[model samples]
Target chain A: MTTNGGADLTRLIEPDRVHRSVYTDDAIFAREMEAIFQRAWVYVGHESQVKQPGDYCTALLGQQPLIMVRHSDGAVYVLYNRCAHRGALLCAKSRGNTGGAFGCSYHSWQYRTDGTLESIPLPAGYEGTRFSPGAADYNLKRAARVESYRGFVFASLSPSGPALAEFLGEARIALDNMCDRAPAGEVEIVPTCFRFIQHSNWKIFMENQLDALHPYVTHESTGRAAAELERQMMARKQKPPLEYHYLSAFTTPFNEWDKLQTVNYPYGHCMLQGYMGLRPRDPDTLAYEAVMREHYGAERTERILGVNIHHVLIYPGLSVQPALQQLRAARPLAPNRTLTEIWHFRLKGAPEAIYRRALAYYNLINSPSTMVNADDLENFWRCHQGLAADGGDWVSFHRNAGQDDEHDGVIASRRGTSEAPMRNQFRAWKQYLSSSEH
Target chain B: MPVVIKKRSRKKAITPKKNSFAQFRVSDDDVILREVEQFLYRQAELLDAKRWSDYIELFDADGIYWMPASLEQITGDGMPSIFYEDRNLMTMRMKRIAHPHAWSQTPAWGTSHIVSNVTLEKVDSRTGDVSVRSRFHMMEFRRDASRHFAGVYHHELRKTKHGYTIRLQRTDMVNGEAPFDYVLLAWV
Candidate 1:
C-alpha cells in the first residue's frame, strides 16, 4: 500500500475512501505522470487535425511536449518536440504547417515531417568530430508506439503495453458513434478551441465528467432558473426551446439518474449511459435521421442512434461525449493545476442544422463562459483547496461500493450515482504504478 | 493583462457599416450621439449597481445579447459563441445569478464596467434604428481572485418615445483566443 519512501500509495486508496495525499502530494503526482500518463495509450491528436501533408499540431503526453505531424506520404507522426542540438523546443506555435521540414529556430537543425534528420548548417565543421548528421540520435525521437483507431490517434511512451485498439476495448464505441453519425463516416476537427486552466488536480476533472450525482446539487441554481422558464412556457401552451432543457436537465431527480448505469472495463475505460436525452423528435433531427438511414440502412442507423451513451472516459485523460460531438482532454501541469482543451467537431456529411445543434451545446455547456462549466470549475478549485488543508483525511467513494457487478473483468455499477468510475480509476492507478514495466 | 492588437487579416472584406461610422458625418447635430453615449453609461451603471430588473427593461422584447467566441466570427447563427441569449435566456441568467445558492457567485462578483469610446456607427432612417460602437474594461473580483476583461462593444439601438432600447449588444473581447484562468460568468 506504500511507495519506497514510506508514503503509502496502497493505503491512499481504500474500497470506500482515498487518502487526501493521493491528490495533494507532489511525489505522487510525479510518479503518476511518469508511470500512468507517459506509458498509457494517451490520445495525441486526430488525423483530421493534420490533413495536409505538412500540417502539424502540438500536444503533451504527461509533461513531455510532442508534435503530431502529417508526413509527405500522408501518415501521422508523433515526435518529441525538441531539437537534437540542444534541449530547445521546436515548433513554438500550437499548430501550423512546417512545409517540407522542421527547421529548429535554435541552431537551425532541420528534420523531415516524419522526424528524420534532413540537414545541418555546416557539414565540414563536423568532418573530424564525432557529430554525424546521419546518426540516429540526431533524428527527432518519437514515442515508443503510435497508432490510430477511426482517425483518433494515440501514442505510448513505453513500448510494452497492449495495442491501441486492444487498450480501447469497449470504449472504442465512443469514437465509432462519433464518426458513424457522419454520412461520409468521418469527422473533422474544428480548428478553434476553448482552452482553460482549472486550479485543481486532473483527477477532479475526470471524475466530475461521469459523477452524475453532483449536477443536481452543484448546478441547482442554473437548473432551477431554466426549469422555471420551462414551466412558464408550458403554462403558456408553447413548447420550450431545446436550449432551455439543456440546462434544466441538470435538475433531473436522483431517482431518474439512478435508473441509468455505468459500465466499467479493465484499464479504467468506463461509460455513463443516457444522462442526456439526445434523441429528440424534432424536425431537424428527423431530417438528419433520414439522411443517416439513406447512407446506412434503416436498421443500422437505428442501432447506431440507439447506443444511448452520454459520456465515455478513455481511462486517464480523454472524456468524450460522442453524441454531442465534443471531446475534452486533460493535461496535468501540477498537483494543484490542470489544463483542459475543449474541442467540438462537425459530422462531415450531416445537415447544417445538426452541426448547429452541436455548436450550441459546445457554447452553452462546454465553453469556459457557461454557467454549467463555471459551477464545476469552482468545485474543482474548492475541492483542491479543501483537500490541501488538515480538515479532511479521506475522500469518500462509499455510495454504491459493494453493489457493483463484475463479470469477466468488466464491472457494472448497479446505480448511476455509484462512484464506480472513481473506484475503477484508482484500481487501474494502482496497477499502473505498481508494475515495474508499464 | 497584456494588450494584444493583432493586425486585421485581409481575407474577409471589412463591412463598411461596422468600420466607417466615424468617416461619414451623419445629421450635422450631435444631440443623438450624446444621448446614445449617456444611455450606454447608464446601462453600465445599472449592471454594476446590481439593478438586474432595471437592466432587463433596457432591452427590446426581441433583443439579443451576444458575445462571439472569436473576433473573426461573423455570425452567431451556426458558430460557437460565448454568450448568445434571447430575452428569455437573459432573464434566466439574471435569475440564476441572483439565486441564493449560486455557488460560483457564493461571495458575489464585484464588477466595474468602464464604458468609453462611444461612437455613432450607423443610422437606419427607415426603421429609426441606430448603431453605436464603444469600448469597455470590466474588472471583476470574487473570492480573493480578481480579473479584468477588455472588449469592444457594438450596440444596435431602436429609438422609442421612452428612450433607446437595445436591439443587439455584441461584445468582442480582445483576449478571446487565450486560455482562461477559470470561468467567465458575467457580461463580457
Candidate 2:
C-alpha cells in the first residue's frame, strides 16, 4: 500500500529497515488495525476468565471492543457489543456473571449467551415490519472464528486465518510451555489485572518486550544499587536475600545480554531466552518441583522445567512469559496512545508458595507499582513524545544486522546480543504487508 | 494520603454503650466505647493528612497488608492478587517512590481517604487483640482529574505495651483491576 506502482512490497520492510511512519504516522496505524489486528488470530481471554456457564469478560482487538463469554452449552463465544435496537453498548461492566442472557439496559432487548436474539422488550413493535427476529442482521454478530489453544482463547474477525495453530506455528511453544509447566498441564488466570495506558505507539512496547538488550542498560542504576546491597550481604558470607537478585539482575553487563540469544520466528512471533536464573534451590521451589515431578514423568518434567524463555511474543499483540505466568496484550488506541493489560497466573494444583513467587515478580517487577515497570513506562512515553517532534526522521534498528544467522527460514542471532530479533520481525511484517490481497 | 474529615464538635450526649466487637467486662462501660471510637478517629485523622510514615508505624513487624486477587481468595489459594505485602515489602514499595525513575510519581497522585462506618467486630481474650472493620470512599486525584475507589478494610489489631499495633490490614478494593488512572506509587 505504501508503494505507488508495481514495486516490491517486501522491499519497504526488509530485514535491515522499516518505514518511519510505522511509528510516527496515523494512517499506517489504521491500516494495521484493519489488515493485521482484524485479520490475525488475536488472543481473546483465558478460559479461567469465563469458567462458569455464563461468565463473560470484555476485551479489545485493535479498536473494536469484543466480548468473550461462556454459553450455557460450555462453548465460548466472541460477540460484538453493539445492541440491535438502539445501538446501546452491552456489557457495561469490565467483567461479571451475565446470568445466562445479555440484556441491553437501553431497550431491554435480550440475547442468549451464545449471541442469538432471544426476545425483544415488546413483541408487537415489529409486527408487520422488516425487523424480524430470525434475520442474521437482527441477531448479535459473532466473530468469524473462535478457537482455544490449551485453554487460551483466540478470535479472528476474518473468516480465514490459516487456523490458530498453523498461524502460531512454532510459537505454539509459548502456550505449550506455559501450560505444560503446570503440574496438571494447565494454568489458571489471575482473575484481576493491572491495566495501564502508555503514551506511546504500541510497536515500541512490543519491540521492547524481547529487546534482550535494554534491561542491562535502562535498568542499570536501580539494578546496580540492589546488586551492591546484595554484594555487601554476600561479603558477610551469608546467603543474600531474594530481593537482592531483583536489583542485581539489572547489573548484568552489556556483553552478558549479547550472550542471551533471541529467536525470531515467522508471523512476527519471536522469543528471548530467560536469564533471570530463577531456578533456586529453596525449600519452596523444591516442594513445587516435587509436585511437578509427581504429576509428570521425569523426562517430560525435566523438559518442561528446562525451558527458560523470558518473553514469547505472539506478533503485533500479546507478549507472553510462560514460566512466570505473565501475559500482556497491547491495544493501540491512537497513533500515540496505547493500552496494555498486565495479567499474572497461577498453576493449578500447585503449592500456594509457588503462586507467591509469581506474585513477587508481578508486584516487584511488572506491577505498575514496581520500579522496573515505572522505568519502562517513562521511557515509552518519552520516546513517543520525542518522535512526535520535528527533530528526527528514522528510529534506527541496524544494530548488528549483517551478522545474523539464518537457516531453513529459522533466523537466529550470531552473537546473543544481535539485532536479528527486530530484523526478523520486519521480515515477517514485509511478508504480511507485501502479500497479494486475499 | 489525605484524610477528608473535619474536627467534630464535642457531643452533649454520646451513646452510652454498644457491644460491637469485644464484650470485655470493661466493654460494657461507656468510657471504653468512647475511648475506642476516639482512637479509631484519631488514626483516621493522621492517615487523611498524608502522614503515611506515621500510619505505617501502627503495624507490627509481622503485619500483612493484603488486597485479595478476587473475592474468592479468602484462603490465599487462587490467582495472584492486587497486593499481598508484608511490612518489609511495604517499606520497599515506599522507598521506590523516593527515587527518580518512577514516572507515575513524577507528578504523584494526590489521594484523599474518605473513611466511614468504623465498627469494632470482635476482641480476643488471650492477647487482648481487637478486630475492626471500616469502609472507605477514596478519590484519587492527578493532573486536575479524579477517580473514585471504594473498599472495605478488615483490620486485625493487637494491644502492644505502648499502643495498638496492626497484625493484619486487608483492604478489599473493588476497583483494583480496573485500569488504574495512575500507578499507586505510595500507600492509599
Candidate 3:
C-alpha cells in the first residue's frame, strides 16, 4: 500500500493491519475525539478519591476536561471543568476538597457538587436575562452521562450510548479482579500519583500495554543488568533480594515471552497472563495471607488471591494491574502528545507490606523517573517520529494474526507476543470510527 | 520525648566552643542522637550501593516503610504510596526484579542518594522510640541519561535489641501535596 495524503479510512484499517497515518495524521485526531473517545465509556477517577461531599478531581474523558465530585448525598458526578460565566476552567488543580460547594475562580460562580448553580457572584447581573440563577444555562455543564462501577468512575461524553456496565461487559472482570482481591471488597487510592506526558499518540500506549513482544527486546539492557546482580548475590550464597525480579522479568528470551498467552477482548480490552510467580513463600506474603484468611475466610481469600492477570488494558487508555493495585489513566494532548497518570492502590485492611510491594512496582517500573519508563518513553517517541517519515506506510499487526480465536466476538491470542492486541484495538477503532456520523 | 532531645542538646552543647562526645556524660541507657544519625547514614549507603536486601533488613520484622502518595498526610483518596508494604511487600518487590520477566530494568539504574539535614528527634526513651527527619537528593543514571528526584522523609523509629528498625517512614516530596513527580520504585 502506498501513502495517500487524502486516504480512504476504510482501506487503511483491516482486522490485521493499519495505516501509520491513523497515528500520525492531524485531521484524523479531531474526528477521533467525536467518533470514538467522546462516545466511549471513559475512565474518569475512582470513587474513593472523593470520600467527602465537595471533593473533586480534574480528569480528561478523551479531550474534554471533566471533574469527578462526590455530592452531599453520596452520589458521584462527572461535570465539565468549565465555568457558567466567561468560560473559565474550574478546579484547575488535579484534585482537592471543594468544602461543600464548587466555586469557580473566574467570577465565583458557586455551584453544588452535582453541577447545579447555587449562587451567582452578582445575582442582579442576570436577573432579567435568560441566564437566571436557577436556569440550567447558568449552572455548570455536565458530562453527557456518568456512572461508577464498583468504585471505578467512568463517564460517556455522548448522552446516548450503551450504559457503562454494558460497555464493560466481559472486560468488567478487569476491575472486578482488582476489587475482589481486597478483603473488604474495596481498594483505596494512595493519595499521591506519578504523572508523565508521553510524546506519542495515545494508541501507541494502548497497543503496547498488551504487546508482550516488546518486553524481551526493548527492555533488554535493564533486564540483563538486574539478572547479573541477582546472580552476584547468589554466588556469595546470599539470598537474592526480590527487587531484582523487576529487571530479570524483562531478560526472558523471546521464546519464553511468546510462550505466555494474551487475550484480546471486545472494545479493545486485553489481558496478559502473569509471567511471574508473585505468590512466593516470602515471609511478608505468608503474613499477608494469614491476615487475609483472618479477614475474609480462607476459601474466598484463596479465590481472590488466585487470579493470574499480569496486566490489563481497559482500551483507549487505561493500563490496570489489579493484583498490584495499579492503574494508569492516559489523556491525549494532541496527535503526538499523551499524558499518563500512574496510580496504585492499597488493598484496604491488607498488610501495609502488601501495599508497599505494589508501591515498589509503582516506582520501579511505572514511575516517570525509572529506568523502565525512560526506556519505554524513548521507544514511543521514536515510533511517532518514524511513522511521520517515509519509512513505511503500514504498521503490521500481522504477527500471529490468522491464529487468533474468535468466539462470539471475543478474540483470544494463543501466544503472549501475538499482535492480536493491536489488531483488537484497531477492530474497536474501526467500529467506533465506522459507526460514527462523520 | 521532646525533653530528651533538649536535654541532650544542653549536655552536648554545654560550652559554646564545640559539641563533642566528651561534653556529654556517657550513659548506655540513653541513645545519643549521633547514633541514630549513623543508622540513617548507613541506610543511605545501602540504598546508594543498591544493596536492596541489606536495605530491607534495616526494618524490623513488622517495620513499615511508606512514601505518601502525595505530600499531605496518608489520608483520603490519592494513590497514597511509594510503597505500602510489610516485609512481604519488600520480598515481592525484590522477587519481581529477580524474575527473568521483569522489564524496566533494561538499563540498570545506578542510583546515588544524598541524605543530609538529618533532624534526629527523640520520641520516647522508655520504648526506645526516636523520630528522625532528613532531606535527600536522588540521581539515577539509566541509558546514559540522568534524572534527579528530591524529597524529605520523616522516620519514627524503635530501637530493638539487635538494631534499629523503622516504625514509620513517611516520604514528603517537593510536590507532596499535589499530583507528584516520579513513580517511586525504591525506598527514598
Candidate 4:
C-alpha cells in the first residue's frame, strides 16, 4: 500500500474516496509524472498533423518536450525536443517543416528527421576530446517506444511495458469507431486546436469527462436557454438547427442520464454511452448516410453509425468523443494547473456537412468561448480551490460503489451517474504508484 | 423583448460575403470618421455594461461575430476558430449568460474596453457602406483575477435606415494562442 517514498498509496486512494493531497500535494504530483505519465503510452500528435516528409509538430509527454516528425522515408518518429549538444530545444515552434535536418539554433548541430545526428559544426575541435558525433548520446533521444493505431500516435518513455494495443485494450474500439465512421476508414486532424489551461489538477478534468451526472447540473443555464429558444422556434412552426441541440442536450433530465451507461476498462480507460441522438433525419445527415452507404454497404454502414459511444476517457490524459470526431489531450503543468489541447478530425471522404457538424459541436460545446465550457471550467477551478483548502480531506466516489458489475477486470456501471469510473481510475492509479517497476 | 426569429436557411451564414458597394471618394471624411468612432465606442460601452440585448442589436440581421484563433485564419468555415457565430448563435449566447443559474457568471465579471486607432479602411460613398479598423484593449475582472485582451477589430458596417449596423466584426487577438487561465465567459 506504501510507495518507495514512504507515502501511503492506499490511504491516498480508497475504493470510494481519495485523499485531498492526491490532488493538491506537490510530491504526489511529481510522483504521478514519473509513475504514470512517464510509463504510460501517452498520446502524441496525430499522424495527420505531420502529413508530409520533413513536417514536424511538438508535443509534451508528462513534462518532457517531444517532437513528432515525418521523415523522408515516410516514417514518423517521436524524439525529445532537445539538442543533444547544449540541451536547447530543437523545435522552437509548435509545428513547421525542418527541411532535411533540424539545425539547432544554439550550436547549429544538425539531426536527421529520425533523430540521428547528421552533422555537427567544428568536427576538428572534438577529434582530440571525448566528444563523438556518431555516439548515441549525441543523437536526439527518441522515446522508448512509439506506436500508431489508425493514425493516432502514442509514445511511452519507459523501455518496457505493454504494447500500445494492449495498453488500449477494449478502449481501442473508441479509435476504431472513429476511423470506421470515415468513408475511407481514416480521419485527418484539423490543424488548429484550442489550448486551455485549467486551474485544477489533471485528474479533475479526466474524471469529469465521464461523470455523466454533472452535465445537467453544471450546464443547466446554457441548456435551459437553448431549450427555451427551441421551444419558441417550435411555437413559430420553425425547425431549430441541430447545433442548438448540442447545447440543449445538456437539459437532459437526471433520470435520462442514468438510463445511459459507462464501461470501465483496465489501465483506467472508461467510456460513456451515447446520449445525444446524433443520428437525426435531417437532409445533411441523410446525405452523409448515403455517402457512407456508398462506400460501406447498408449493414456495415448501419453498424458503424450505430456504435453508441459519447465520450471515452483514456485516463491520466485523453478524452475522446469518437462519434463527434473530437478528442482532448490533457497535459499536467503543475498540481494546480493543467493544459488541455482540444483537437477534432474530419472523417476522410465523408461529406463536408458531416465535418461541419463536428465543427459545430467543437465550437458550441468545447471551445473556450462557449457557455458550456465556461461553466465546467468554473467548477474545475472551484473544486481545486476547495480541495486545496482545509475544509475537506476526502473527495467521495461513493455513488453506487458496490453495485457495479465487474467481469474479468472490466466494470460496467449499473447507472450512468455512478462514480465507478473514478474508482476504476484510482485502482489503476494505485497500481502504477505502488509498483517499483519504472 | 423583440424576438429575432431564427432562419432555417441552409445558406453558409458565417461566410464573409462580399458586399456590393459603389466605390467612390467620400466628400466628408471627417464626418464619416467621427460617426464610425462614435458607433464603435457605443458598441464597446454596451459590451462593458453587460447590455446583452443592446449589444446583439448592434449587428445586422445576417451579421457575424468572429474571433479567429490565429492571424492567418481568413475563412471561418472548415477551420477551427475561437468564435464564429451568426446573429442566432449570438442571441443564444446572450440568453444563456443572462440565465439566473449561469454558474460561470456567479460573481459577475466587469469588462472595460478602450477603443482607439479608429481608421476608415474603405467607403462606399453612395450607399454609406464603410469598412472600419480599430484597436481595442479589454480588461475583464472576474472574482480575484483580472485578464487583459488586446486585439484589432475590423468592422464591416452596413448603413441601415436608422444608423450603421455591423455586418461583420472580426477580432484578431494578440494573445489568441496564449494559455488562458479559464474560459472566456463573455465577448472581449
Best by lDDT, which number? Answer: 4
Estimate every model's Cα lDDT from 0 to 1.
0.87, 0.75, 0.76, 0.89
Query: lDDT per residue, candidate 2, A222-320, as tens digits?
Result: 675566556655787867656457656877888888888888788888888888886778898889889888999788888988998888999878899
TM-score ranking from best to worst? 4, 1, 2, 3
Q: Stretches of candidate 2 above 4 Å error?
A: A1-20, A124-128, A221-247, A434-438, B1-58, B69-79, B98-155, B172-174
**Lowest lDDT 10-residue stretch of candidate 4 chain A:** A1-10
DockQ of 2: 0.27
Give residue B93's error in model 1 in angstroms.
1.2
State every prediction's TM-score relative to the real structure: 0.93, 0.83, 0.75, 0.94
Q: In model 2, which residue pairs have backbone atoms overlapping below 3 Å?
A: A258-A416, A258-A417, B2-B48, B3-B48, B21-B121
- Tell me how far the alpha carbon of residue B61 in candidate 3 is from the true structure, in angstroms, after superposition: 19
Best by TM-score: 4
Docking level for model 1 = medium
Error of 4 at A389 (Å): 1.3
Off by over 4 Å in 4: A1-6, B1-27
lDDT of 2: 0.75
Error of 4 at A111 (Å): 0.7
Which consecutive 10 residues in model 1 chain A have the weakest lDDT in total?
Answer: A1-10
